[model samples]
Structure formats: C-alpha cells, structure tokens
Target: MKVLPRQRKAVLINSVLGVAVLAGAGGAYSAVTSHSDSSARADARTVTVAKGTVLATVSGSGSLSSPSDAGVNFTTGGKLTQVNVKPGDKVSRGQLLGKVDATAAKETLAQDEASLTAAQANLTKVQEGQPSTSTGSGSGSGGSSSRGSANTAPTPTPSPTVDPAQLAQAEAQLTQAQNAVDAAQRAVDGTTLRAPVAGTVASVSAKTGDTVSGTGGNSTAGGSGGGSASGSNSGSTSSGSSSALSGFVVLTNPSGMQVTANFSEADALKLKPGQAATVTLNAESGTVLNAKVLSVSSLPVSSGSGSGGGGGGGNSSGSAVQYAATLTITSPTSNLRTGLSASIQVVTGEASGALSVPTAAVSGTGANRTVTVVNDDGTTQRTPVTVGLEGDSADQILSGLSEGAKVQLASVSASGNGGFPSGAFPGGLGGGAGRTRGGGAGGAGGGFRTGGGGGGRG
Candidate 1:
C-alpha cells in the first residue's frame, strides 16, 4: 500500500476539478431559477373591451319530452285487470286500451239501481191518493172477550192528490238515486281504460295483475318511462337532463313531435309563449332544430326547488322548483326519439350590432359597474363604466369606456411557473390565458364563457 508520488499528485488534481464542477452547477441552478421567475412575471394579459351585438338568453336542458296534455291518463285509479294494448300498438278514440277490476263498480251499480227503483215506486205512491181505512179484530189474552171489537170504515178525508212537500221529498230522493246510478255506471265503464284520442301506444307498464293509480283522466299519457322524475336528469349531456314517465301507457302522435324541458323560475319569467328558440338533441348532435317557446309554465314544477339558471345550465339538487316549458320543433323528424336528451336556448332578450367588451373586463354590480383599464405604463386603473348589456362572452358598453381601451384582463406573476401555464388541471395555473390582444376570445379561464347570450343592461 505504498503510493507512488506521481499517482498521488494526479489524485489531488482530479479531486480539485470535481469540487469546481459542483460549485459551477450550484451557480447555474440559481441563474436558471431566477430567469424563469422573471419570465413568468413579465407576461401580463391586457384586453380591450369592444362594442358588439349581444343576446340575453335563457337556457334550459331536459329530455325531448311531450306536453302534459299529450298524455292519456286514467281519471280513476284501480287494479289493472286486463291490458289489451302493448307498446307500439295504434288505436283510435274510444278504443279499449286496457281494463281494470270492475267487480266493485258493478256491485255499486247494482245497489244504485235497486235504490232508484224503490224511490220511483215510493214517488208513484205519493203522487197517487191514499184512502184512510179502519179495521177491528177481536182477541182474548186470558179469557174470551165479552164482545169483539167492531169493524169501522171511516169516511175518507179526501186525501189531496197534490202533496207538495211529499212530492218534493220523493222527487229529490228519486233524483239522488238516479245520480248514484249514473255515477256507478260511469265508474264501471271507467274500469276499462280507453283511448280518448287516436295515437300510437308508446308504452304499457301495467300487466294483468298490476294495480295502477288513475291520473284523473280517461287515458294514459304516451311516451317513454321517463315521464316521471325517473327520467329526470337521465340521459343528461352537455345539453340537458330529463324526467320519467309516470303514465302506465303513453300515446304519441308521431307526426306531432316536440321537446319539453324544465327551466328555473327566473328563466321562466323571461320566457313567454311564441318566443324564438333553438333546440339541440344529444342523439342528433349535429341537428340544431329550429324551435319556439310554446309556453312557459307559471307554476313551479316542484316544491321549494329551482335552479339558478341563465344561459347554459339546468341541473338542480333537492326540492328545486322548475317551471315546465314546451318547445315546439318546427322540423322534427323520425330521427328525433322520445327520451332523447336535449338542450334549448330561448331568446329572452336580444341586442344586435351593439358595442361590447369582454365580460371579464367589467366588474362590480348595478350602477357601480366598472372595469380595470390598463394604462400605457405597466399599471391598471379602475375605470367607471355604464354597461348596457352583459353577455356570456362580452358586455355591451353603453357609455363611460370607449373602444380600443386596453382593459387589464388579469395580472400574472411569473415567480411560480412559466412552463405549462395550463397547469395540471383543467384550469391550469394562473387564470388561464385571458382574451388575447385579438377580439372574440372565450371558452377559457376555467371554462366560464358559454353562448352569445348577454344580460341586457339598457
């Protein structure tokens, strides 16, 4: 283990060189880190709030449903005894669709008939004169009576043929009995479910032994099982959600097709009958059907339940009241199927060819509306603004701010990350890129912007 002088000398040199390399790496790391942080801070996004046309719209999504009137429902509830029609069966008005257990109805009818007959006989006897007569019979309890009671015929106190009180009472009883008979007969007939109008049977959930509740109608509503909330929120897509069919049998007029959706109460207020709208189906995504707001229900769909909605939102948790809306599809075809998810946008208000700016640029509420304006220097000033209309993408500038004014969309700090600004998540790092210098940019920054709808300010 004796070391040579030259070899020892070489080891010392190599060790020194390794230490120098470590020192150099440490310096380089600091420089690189500093440069990266500076780069991130230098990138600030400045945007101009311009003027443009904006539409304030109310959007709602749900299954392409049917009008409540389109459903054929049973007016009376009963046990389903027979189902004559299955799904897809076509029938006409007054056609028997199914039958219920009518044994009870029949018994009720029989009793009513007997009562009616007795009432009529009593009435007849009252209308006719009755003579008073007296008769005596002899009887002995312990011993034979000394003399038998004598039979006597009293002179008839002429009975008035017209006894107004007796006549009225008898008449009322007869009428009541007749009503019972009619009601009982109707109930018996109701046991047999029939089609009130002609259409195709879309479904039949009731079997022979199934007990079905009456919808207080004579027929069943036609559609898929989604007529009830069972269909609610099902088949929901980016477009909307739907509800279930509570009807046992659904009848659909294939030629008459429409989409029924529920919207928040706020949106409902903006909607009115005959308003213009557009409907998009989840199935035929490419098909943007032209439609109109047939009606917006004034009543709340559910109790204590309504979703906050404006443009492009429809989900609601528990007890959220929604107003039902009917959209008549002007060009619905065979391609449109029941229970298909759909989204609709009703033009509650519109302002065309007006001045507008990025909605993000405008902040504050009501009369205190303002936007942050970027000065020529690397500084921003909050500028008072008179906003006319606010849209999903932009807001209409009524006054205060002028066109081409560079509004500070957002200020970014580079100390964190210069690389992968769109961080690991959907939102990325800092508020993702704002409206670039270019106009009409959105669907960015955590996916906030939606349709061209704007809240009308003026």
Candidate 2:
C-alpha cells in the first residue's frame, strides 16, 4: 500500500503517544500497590490474652547519696596546725581530724582557773567566819570604861559570824568563776576538729597551716537521724568552688549508702516506705542493686533547704513539682560512692496469675478502657475492658473477654484513607487510565483515544 510521508509521520507520532500513556498508567498502579503493602506491614498484629504476672512500677532518675554524710568543720577559727586525715581515710566517732593552734585558748584557760581558785577560797572563808573590823559597842563595857579609866580591859570581841548575805555573794561568785573556767576549757577543745560520726573521709578542704574562719560547713552526718532524704545542698568534689564541699573534711558512712531520686507528684503519691525498689547505676548499666523506699518527702524538692542529700539527685527545674524519695540499698557494694547517677524503679503494685494482654493492645484509661478483639471469623470488635495493675509490658485484664481471647495491637499508621495518594491530581493520567477505557479516559481523553487506537490497530 502506498502512503504519503505526512500521513506516515502522524501515525508514527500517535503510536509513540499511546505507548507513553500505557507506561504512565502501569507505573501509577505499581506505586499504589507498593504503598498499600507497606501500610499493611505497619498495621496491627493479633495477640492472645493469657494469665501472667504484672508489676506496676514508678520510674525516675536520681543519684547515690548517704544519709550519714557529715561535713566536719572546726567550731572556732584559728590557724590549722595539724591534719591527721585525708580523703579516703577511715575514722571512728570522736576521732580527732585536725587541730588549730590552741595557744590563746590555753592562756584563757589558765586565767579562768586562777579566778576559780580565788573564788573557791573566798567562798570557804565566808562559810567559816568573815573577819569584821567594826567594833561592837556593849553597854556594860561602856560603863566600866567610864568608871575605871584605861585599866578596864577591852572585852574580847565575840568570834566573827558568817553573814548570810556575804556567804550568798561568795557562792554566786564561785559559780560564776566555775562557769567561766568551763567555757574556757570548751574554747580550748573547739580548737580541734573531730568526726561527729564514724565514716570514711570523702574529702578534705582544709590543710595544715591554712586559717579557717569556721563559719560554714558545720552540718552533722546522718542527717535527721534516720534513712530520710535530707535534700542537703552538698556539692561534689568535681567542682572546686562549691561551698558545700568547702568543709574541713567531708565524711561519708559507706554502709549508709542510699539513693535519692525525685518523682513527679503523680508518682510520688503512689510511693511509700518499705516498697521494693531496684537501682541501676548510670555508669555501670548492668549492675542492679536491690533496695527499698526509705522515705518520701512531703514537700517538693524546691521547697526544702536541706543540706543532707549527697549529689543533686532531685529535679529542681521545670514547672512540675518533684518530691524527693530516699531508697536504702539492702546490700550495697563497697564500690558504691555518693554522687553517682542512677535510675530507680519502685514496685508500687503487682498482680499475679491474672488474665492479661499486651499493653499496646489496650487503649484509653479507667472505666472507659477498651481493646480491639479479633473474632474467629476475621472480624474486629471494640470491647470495653476492666484492667488492673497496668504494667510496662502487659496489663491485667479483669473482665471483658475470656482467657485465650485475641486482641489486635494498635497500628503505627493511621487508617481509613482509601489506600490512595491524597495529593494526586484529579482525573489525571493515573486515575483516568485506572477508571476507563480509551473513549472515556482521563487527562485529554479524546486525543489519547485517537492516538491510542491508531497505535493499537497498527
């Protein structure tokens, strides 16, 4: 058959256009299918409810501290003469840590002792008989002296009597002198620093020959006398300028090592003394220690001015109120040190041998809690459930679905979008070819039909 060049060229162009249209349609269909497959993979999976144990725990981060941590300081200011202990030295209660020069103190004591001795002697004389220089005039003696001139012998003065008033004055003076002597002795003793409690020296800020004002760091170790979070503002040795660590020496009772953590108000309310707790050190993640809640502070961490807690364990930032909690390590290791960061988990509630399901399968809370049950017929139904002891991995199901009942896990992706691209052009090439044949195709349908038919028939 003979064909003109112009006609042939038109036919060739139509054939190419038709092939392009088919290729576009195929690509669109493949994209939609791939997206649907990924969405399915991201969807929910079914799990059977069964009997298990669930532990409800309140978790928080904190730091290691010792209730028996004491900041040893000199009671009176003087030149530091001797330091017997350094950091890491073990000492007993009343052990002398260091001393300031006691020369002036000794001098004061000597003067007070002399005064006390003089006062004692004066008191003794008053109690016996105070010598009276005043002569007593007697009527008989006066008459005799008037009659017999100088020959009348002066009657011997009666033996001196102790005046009650004079005795009382002397006793009072003695008491005053005794008190002064005791005070002087205490001043002399105050020149030396002693450990208030038995513990290891955690740090020493003062050295021999340094003059200390003795104005700060007078806190007693074992604060408040129990296993309670003192929330002390003690700073770590990591910072040199911290005044909290600026004591003569920092003493820590290694045996009293405990953890101090802060919990939100919601969690704090659920915590109480004697609750079982677990502590994990931040530096040693694998080391787990058993402990129990020793105390929970009634006031927020920010509200208290406690100088008892070691390391800034409680959270004082943010608008939320955080309560300090103390946990005692039942079996502490020798390696445990104050100011070490740790995470705490206290078991607040527990349920055993109860019907439970994966926590992810449950939605909502309280009386309105619900789960999606997967029926045997492949249908899903939203069912209300009564839950108890909502744990980390699983939740206790009190009712609404028997044991062995299956529930669908919550989907990661949203549902009900028709499995199609939302922003795709309306009735465009993908949609047009997807919905109709050549004559009713979308995206310039009439032109596509003409070129498409010619390419197909050819």
**lDDT per residue, candidate 1, 376-456, as tens digits?**
886778888887766656778888777778886543333132332332122222233332211122222222232212222
Candidate 2: segments with Cα more than 4 A from true spot: 1-44, 124-168, 206-210, 213-243, 302-318, 375-384, 412-458
Q: Estimate each model's TM-score.
A: 0.52, 0.63
* Model 1 TM-score, all chains together: 0.52
Per-residue lDDT tens digits for candidate 2, residues 157-232, read 6567888999999999999999999878877777777776777887776678888654323334322211111112
Enumerate residue pairs that collide in model 2. 68-222, 232-306, 232-307, 232-308, 232-309
